[model samples]
Target: MNERLLLDHLLVRGPASRADLAKITGLSKPTVSAALAGMEDSGLVHLAGEVLGRPGPVTSLYDVTAGAAHIGAVDIGRDWIRVAVADLRGRFVGRKDGRNAAKNSEDLVSRVRELAQAAAGQAGLPWTSVITAVVGSPGVYDKDADRMIFAPNLPGWEGSGLGDRLRTALGVDVTIENDINLAALGEHAYGAGHGIANFALVSIGTGVGMGIVVNGELYVGARGAAGEVSFLPAPEPVPADDDTLRHGLTESLAAAPGVVRAARAAGLHLDTAKEVFTAAAEGDPAALEVVHAEGRRIGGLIVAVASVLDPELVVLTGGVGHNLALLGDAITSRFAELGPLRPRVVASTLGDSGVLLGAVARALSQAWDHIFDLRQSGVQPRQSGVQYGMSR
Candidate 1:
């Protein structure tokens, strides 16, 4: 499996020298040399360049050849569908991001097809060339039913045959996952959570959710509802309407609309959450008060999560959570007053690309697994989606 291991590492981290690969995989010099020779003979890898300005001997770097295979990743949000296509070597081919106007399951399927095809076209590959596709959506995915649940923010998504429709439309193996969970994976692999053993990412956006990573792996509980933090009881009074109940309690208090409500109650004429943050930056008392309250609510949620899981880091993200400059000091003060051993809170550096990048990471994982399995079994790898059921 040395060649398999080398290829996988290169696909993830890009090109590297034999010494670097050996160091990363803990393989010896002779073992790495043999594996590289075999991979080069098989036409899977080629010499990219040589590193200069090193201490001693010059090192030759190898990269995976392009057009070996393709993977598609999609981020399906309430208002947009972002699509990206990458090759087996982890090189991006194309991307398409557009408004989501789907009102129901059928419309959703059509929109996904259109976006995926356009992305593949831009990448100079046919849509049929895509081998595997992973979709990051906003809900707890019930794999048994193959539909989304507890996703009130996405109207008409619950109980719909969205998953099967996507599979049929895309004509590839499809896997559905919670968007926030994907964001956590994105952050862990490429952003703030890198190198942290245990951490929690709390996203405050159109809705509130948490994604927990423990011991360098995503910890989705039985029935895939581990990080559904929005249902936690609200700390303050909320709208108390049927719609608000459908949306969770904590979410109604900490998400974007919650900020607007706090502003209006304080007699501020702000129209959106961004405006409120802007007003606060300008030193408006009413807006600053709302900002402080929102920070406290977020800080309380962080404390609650820390008390149970005790993660080392807490990454704040999403539409409301990413305003770190405004909320950072307030959240820190709230936690400091409470007690010791509180997790350090930080903002997401990945920004809007978190979900989509995570989808790509997951898709490449599955694709590589299938390729390795084919090599082991002496069977040719096909474009069909390899069947595997993973916890969301």
Candidate 2:
């Protein structure tokens, strides 16, 4: 029913000849020619050359122009606000970072505008050239309510319309999502989950989060809060300890803050999670024990994920995930002990840019639809080829 989807269906199936495009989309040859011509003239698509099978002149091949549009991706983490300028092809042309999003959404909006303006200048385009912006946050962002529902870790973000603020400041539409959702989609599109049937992206950072992709699509559970693993209860040594109850149950115990607390009790003056990890690398026995224990705890967590979803692999990302060498074998040995049923664990391929790239990818996907929709003829249905086999 939707022509835009039809055109995209053709574009995704690989470059097609005009006749083949018509055949694939069930559009008349003349209609296909008109659509292709319109798209090429607008600079949204270009000719890639021709086919030898056709008699007379070679047919022209068409491809979507990547630079014709762009998306601004922003990641508002605890310490820094990372922004990236990326084209439709998901290539990041520029990047910039500023202070954290803080308690106030207004400050974040201003910073985003400044960075978006800078990124557009860097890309040799105007702000309007950016189709949309995606902001990834640690909190639960309620899209319809236009508010960040439950983010105690972020002080001034409770009743903010982050999307509206950024859209207003930058003069472009904006979308906000859980940072893990962005990272999960990123891994699925360009990282370890590329072509994998089932995969999970687990990030160990200032907090723990996860993004899940099942059957080749991101699984965003109801209420957009699917992968909130940080609050899942962990086993506590002292059953009746109120302080232990506040620290989180299970998954939170191995997060960055949790690791710091564990190290400090063992006499390490660690100001950040990085220090705790560094101590472990240098064979500080207390730090080593704390980190390795965390690793085993993480492994147990993985067992739950694997058993529930049975993803093909689990990708670990962020500062803590990248330092798997120091976290000890408790994770690997424990997971391995789960036998083949335990999903294989590997480090994230995208490093810190995983969420940034993902936000860019989401923006690009949205823009791709817009670009194709404007071309009009891309939507008309075309015919399909039939192959004859040995008939019974």
**Alpha carbon lDDT of each predicted model:** 0.85, 0.74
Q: Against the hidden reference, what TM-scores do the models get?
A: 0.88, 0.84
- Separate clash counts for every candidate: 0, 13
Off by over 4 Å in 1: 9-38, 49-61, 89-91, 379-392
lDDT of 1 by residue, 194-291 (tens): 99989999999878999999999999899888989988989887778888887888999899988998899999988889899999999999899999
lDDT of 2: 0.74
lDDT of 2 by residue, 1-392 (tens): 33353347545675667777777777888877776775666565677767778678877777766676678898878777888888766788778777775556677667778877887777777766677788888867887778875455565676656667766897766788889889988888888888897989888887778899888887888897777776676744634365444434553577777778888888988987888888888888988888887888788778878878888889988777777777538787777777666677888878888889889878877776655544453332112121111010
lDDT of 1: 0.85
lDDT of 1 at 26: 100
